[model samples]
Target: MKSSIVIADDHPLMLKGMMNYLSSLGYNIVGSATDGSTAYNLIVKLKPKIAILDIRMPHKTGLEIAQDCKLNALDTKIILITFDKREDVYKKAKEHNIYGYILKEFAVEEIETCIENVICDRPYFSKELVPNLEKTYTNTDYTSLNKLTKTEIKILKQIANNKTSIEIADDLNVSPRTVDKHRSNIVNKLKLHGIHNGLFIWASQNKDIF
Candidate 1:
C-alpha cells in the first residue's frame, strides 16, 4: 500500500505547493491542514503513516505537536520542515524523535527520499544540515548526559524549551513536586550549583546534549 501522509503549513502557497508535489509523487495524500492545531488534530484522528509539518505555525509549533504525539504514544511518524538551522531547534527535533528534518529550501528535492526513509523506520536529516549536526554531536558532552536518567533527559529537554515546572508536570502527567524533584536531581547531576537559573542556563547552552 502507498504510505498515507498528512501535511500542515501556515503559508497558503507553501502548503498548496507541497500538497501538489507530494500528490504527484504517488503517495496517498490523506489530509492537509493550514495550522498547527488543526494539523495535530487531523493526524491524531487519521493516524496516517506520516505527518509533514512546518516548524512554525499558528497555535502550536511543529515540534510542540511532535512532542505531544510522542508523549501520547501516537503511531504517526513526524517530519518537520523548517527554514531554520539553529542547533537548538535541531536538538529539539531529535529529542522529540522526529523521523525527518527537511530544510524548506530542499523540500522539493528531498521530501520523497525522506518519506521513503522514515516509512522504513530510518531517520532523515536534510543533507544541508547533516554536517553541522554531526559537528554538534561530536562536541556534545555525552558523559554528562549519561549521568541523567531518561525521565531527567525528557524534563531537561522541556526545560531547554523554556517550559516551567508546572508545564512539564502537566505534560508528563506528574505532580508539580515530582517535576521539581527531577529538576533538582538534574541540576545536581550536572553540577549546576551556586548559579542563578543554573538548570535553565545549562539547558540553553547544552542543547545538543538533550
Candidate 2:
C-alpha cells in the first residue's frame, strides 16, 4: 500500500511545494500544516505512516514533536527537514529515534528517497551531513561533545567534579547502574574505546562546557 504522510513547515510556500511534490510522487498526502502544534495534533489524530516536519516551527519544533512521538510510542516515523547543520541538533534527532534528517535545499532531491527508506524501517540522513556526522565518530574536541545527551552532560559534569558514579546516582536520585549506563553511552558516543578512565579524563578537560 502507498504510505500515508503528513507534512508541516512554517514556510507556506515550502509547505505547499513539498506537499504537492510528494503527492506527485504518488504518496498519499493526508495532511499538511504550517505550524508545529497543529501539525502535531494532525499527526496524532490521523496517525499517518510518516510525518515530515520543519526543524524550526512555531509552537513546537520538529525535534520536540519527534520526542513526543517517541515518548508516546506512536508508530509515525518522523523526518526532520532543516537548513541547520549543527551537530547537536543531529545528535538530538538521533537520540529521539527520528527516522530521517534532510536538508531543506536537498529536500526536493532527497525527500522521496528518504520517505522510501524510512517507510521500509530504514533510517536516512542527507548526504551533506556525512562529513560532519563522520567526524563525531573520530574527533575528540568540543565538536564531539555534541554527541552527549543532557543527562550525560550532567553526569559528566559531576564526574569532572570528582564525584563517583554512586555519588552521582545519589545526587540525581537514580540508581548507580543507571548512572553507569549513561556513562557507557557517553563513552560510546565520544568513541573513547581502549582508553583508561576516558570519560573522567575527557570530562575533566571539558569541564567548561558544563
Candidate 3:
C-alpha cells in the first residue's frame, strides 16, 4: 500500500503543517516528530512505507537516519525536506539513497509529486533545484507516460473504458491484486496525483497517447 507516512522537522509549525497537508491528501500519517531521533525511532517502530524528514534536526540529521535505514536494511524510502539547495547535499542524499529531495519553500507545492514518484521507485527532486538534477530527473513532460510497460498500457485502456479491477484482471488473465498493482504503476508512471479518479480520468482523456 502507498500509505503510512512518517514526517519530522525541528520546527513545530513545519512538522504540523506537513502532517496536516499529507493527511488531507489521503495519505496515512502514521506518526510525526519535532526531532530527527524521534523520527527515526518512529520509523523503526511503525515501519511506515515512507519517511519525510527535515534535512537537519537534533540528535540525527535526515541523512544520518537515511544511512541508518540502509545499514539496517530497512525498506522505508526516505524523502528529505530542506531549505538547503547545495549540490553537495543533493550528492550526499544520493549516496544515502534518499528517494525524494524537496525544498521546504515549495514543500506544499512539490510534496504530492515527490511522494508519487518516490512510491513508484523514481527519484524525485524539487524542480526549483533543476541544476542539481540529472537529465531524466530534470524538467519532464507528459512523455513520461512512455515509461509504462505494454501490459500497463493495456490495463489503462481497460480503465479508460470504465472497467473495474476484477474485470480487468479477468480479461488479462491475471489476479485482481495484479490488476491493482498495475493501476498503481500506471498512476506513478504517469505522475498523476491530487486528481480525483486520476487513472480513469487520465486514461479517458489521453486515449490516443496510449
Candidate 4:
C-alpha cells in the first residue's frame, strides 16, 4: 500500500507546491497544515506513516514536533524540510532521528527520493549541501583529515561552520568540558598549536573540504 503522509509548511506556496507534487505522484496525503500547532494536531489525529514538516514554524518548530512524536512513541517517521544548512540544525534533526531532511531549494527534486527512502526505513539528506560548499571554494583537499577520528572530524566540521564550543557541545549532546577536551585534541591532531583560534581558522579556510 502507498504510505500515508501528512505535510506542513507555513509558506502557502511552498506547502501547495509540495502537496500538489506529492499528490500527483499517487502518495496518500492524509493531511496538511500551514502552521505548527495545526500540523501537530493533524499528525496526532491522523497518525500518518510520515510527516513532512517545515523546520521552523509559528507555534512549534519541526524539531519540537518530532520530539513530541518521540515522547508519545508515535509510529510516524519525520522528514524535515528547510532552507537552513546550519550544522546545529542538522545535528538536532539527527538527534531526533529525522528520517529525511531536504533543503527547500531542492525540495521538489529531492522529495520523491526522500519519501521513498524514509518509507523504506532509510535516512536521506539533500545533496545540495555538498554542492553548495563546492560553489564557494574549489580547493577540496582532504589530506589532513585522515589523522582525526570521526567524532573529532565532526567537531571540526561544526567548528569550521563557525559553531562555538558551547553550541557544538549542545548540538552533539556532550558537555562543554568534553567539547573543550576534544578541541584540545583537535588542535593537537591538526597541529594548529600556538595559533589563536587556529583550529577554527583552518576549518573555516578549508570549510568546503569538510
List where candidate 1 sits over 4 angstroms from the true fold. Answer: 139-210
Candidate 2: segments with Cα more than 4 A from true spot:
138-210
Candidate 1 has what TM-score?
Answer: 0.66
Model 3: residues >4 Å from true position, as ranges? Answer: 132-210
Pairs in steric clash, model 2: none
Candidate 1: minimum summed lDDT over ten consecutive residues — where? 133-142
Using Cα atoms with residue i matched to residue i, what is each candidate's TM-score against the true structure? 0.66, 0.66, 0.64, 0.62
Locate the minimum summed-lDDT window of 10 residues in model 2. Answer: 130-139
lDDT of 2 by residue, 1-210 (tens): 489999999999999999888888798999999899999999999999999999999999999999899899999999999999988888788778888899999999999888987775556778888556645333456677787788998898888776877789999999999998998998888777754345654665567766
By lDDT, the candidates rank as 1, 2, 3, 4
lDDT of 4 by residue, 149-177 (tens): 88998998888765777888899999989
Cand. 1 Cα-lDDT: 0.85
Kindly report which residue pairs in candidate 1 clash with one another.
Answer: none
What does the lDDT read for residue 132 in candidate 1?
70
Per-residue error (Å), model 1, residue 136: 4.3
